[model samples]
Target chain A: MAPAEIRNALASHPFLEGLPEKYLDLLSKLAFEVSFGQDEIIFREGDPSSLFYLILSGKVALEIASPGRHVIIQTLEAGDELGWSSLLENTSKQFRARCLEPVRALAFDGARVVALCEQDHEFGYHIMRRALGLVAERLRATRIQVLDVYSPKGVRAQ
Target chain B: MSTASHAAAPPARPVMEPVPVQIRSVVKETHDTFTLTVAPPPGDPVSAFEPGQFSMLYVFGVGELPISISGDPAVRESLTYTVRSVGQVTYQLVTRRPGDYIGIRGPFGTSWPLKEARGKSVLIVAGGIGLAPLRPAIYSILRHRGDYNRLVILYGSRSPRDLLYRKEFAAWGLLPDTQALCTVDYGGVSWRGYVGVVTTLFRHVRMQPQETVAMICGPEIMMRYAARELEARGLPPAQIYLSMERNMKCGAGFCGHCQLGPYFVCKHGPVFAYPEIKPYLDLYEL
Candidate 1:
């Protein structure tokens, strides 16, 4: 996509809804559009975190491989972000992200984005705050899932 | 002397008697849950019920259990119940065939606030079998579509296979001003819908908290979390309702078995405003 179009997309995204015009322009310069087919593994666990993603459309599953099974930890869809770990330096992915449907997303090089953040503290603060919100939301969801609230035993206990 | 003695005896309370109704049909909803339609004898129609009311079902040689009415309230010819075969009584109730007779008592308890919600959007949050109780309210709102604004249904189940009324959910989503979304706690490779707890889906839908009335069901923990999230989104406690379940023996307040705080769940409610029961909900071993 062209730089102007990328900037427009970033501006419209919920995560960056109120991002300043200059930052949108800066982030757009670092982002490139990417797409993947269904069932493709975008990144595997322990893979070097290279790119951060903001999903434009379709679904992806965050999963973990267990003995004889693959457990889906959560499913992210349009308007959701993936690969927050990429924002940190020298980190590896904790979960495998696989496309559950054909997906389109905006990809940003982690090192370049990190450099931009350091250069512009205000921009870095905005980005880090949103990422922290996403992490807290995911942690809350994970706790609810662990409760097994729908089990028959859980119902009876209530 | 015999005539005087007979005249002095008090009459038995008709409300306590179980009326025999024949099972019309049974549809297996999932591996463990079944929906049964029961009808009163010919020339006698079953009493109408508001959404969220429950009936005490008695299976001969087994036992009686309280189940929410899952059918449309407008259709008074028969009453429907969705039963999960988790115990001996529920198992026997689900296994009964057509032409079999089972006893049905009062279609008792409080109902969803459909009357108050007529001019505003209705938000339904159901988990697992909790959907069964809320299904009737959905039907009522759809039947009188102009009476309400937006209709949003957020449903969550244990997995893709455990979802109820799968086809109906698609149909509901197709209606104008209605949105239906389903999520599961777990998903297999082929499942493409939202995979998360019910609360996670709250952010995806837009609501005018002041103009919305929310009804929630499922396990107590799920309802507690759902209510908390709705409150965080600016909905008041009075506008939120939850269906509470307990070991109910008598369908009337005479039996103290179903007591929750100051109320009897069987008589006073299976549906209660959040604040009315909020304190009891968090009380340990209450």
Candidate 2:
């Protein structure tokens, strides 16, 4: 994608909806377009979290492998972000992300973004705030999933 | 509480009498749920019902249970109910064979506000079998498609296998102005749909909050969360509705069994505006 097009995409994403133009311009410099085919593993659990991605289209499933089964924890779609842990330091992916369909995303190198954050405190603050919101939203969704709210026992108990 | 009246009141209607209807067919919707279609005796066509109304179904020699009428309101030849076999009465109700007779006491209770919702977008959030009651409203809206603005359905269940109306979800999503999305709490490797609670789908939906009427049903807990999310998204409390469930005995309000606060769920509602029931919803075991 062209540099101008990349900036526009970053500006349009929900995560950076109100982000200042300078930050988008700076982030765009560090962003590159990436694609994955169906069933392709974008990253596996325990892998180094090197890149953060903003999904442009299609679905990706976050999953875990147990003794004899692979369970999907959640599915993220267009306009959703993945590899949030990459925005932090000394952390690795907590789950595997597999493309459910052909996927197009904007990928950013974590180390460069971290360097940019340290060089610009305001940018760091804005990016981390949005990341925190994303984490909170996922935490809330996981809690509801843990409740097993749709089961007969769960329904009656409520 | 004095029983001294100048004249004795006339006897009330026999609301307890159950009208025997023959089961026309029983379709298994999931491992634990069955949709039963019943037809009334000859010349006594089944009564018409508004969407969201429920009936007290009696399985002879077993017991009776309250079930929402899940079929299209436009088709009055028969009434359909989706029963989840979680107990003895429900087990008997779902196990009955075609041509077997069961008693139905009503097309009772209040219904979805489809009339008031005309010209407005309809947002339906249902979890598990809660979708059964909301299905009628969907049919009614689609039957008169031009009368409504948009139809948005967000449904969630325990797993992909537990989803109701799976084929219809695809059909509805194809409609010009309808958006239907389903999610599950858990999904296996083969399941490709969204995996999250019903509330999580709200972010994907676009609606004019002021011009939309929200209807939700599920476990009360789910409804509570869904309603809260809708309100957070700018929907007015008055425009949001929820279908409440309770221990209903008499189809009429005569029995105190279905009371919730100052209202009798059977007579006053099975469907209530959010603000009207908000206070009582959080009260434990009320």
User: Of the candidates shown, which would achieve the greatest DockQ relative to the real structure?
Assistant: 2
Give one digit per residue, the lDDT tens place, for model 1 in B43-136.
4423567888888899987989889999998887888999988889999999999999999877777888888788999999999999999999
| i-RMSD of model 1 (Å, 1 decimal) | 2.4
TM-score of chain B of each: 0.94, 0.94
Q: TM-scores across all candidates?
A: 0.90, 0.93
> What would the TM-score be for candidate 1 when compared with the true structure?
0.90
Interface RMSD of each: 2.4, 2.7
lDDT of each: 0.86, 0.87
* Candidate 1 docking classification: acceptable
Candidate 2 displacement at residue B31 in angstroms: 0.9
Specify the highest-lDDT model's number: 2
Candidate fnat values, all:
0.48, 0.65
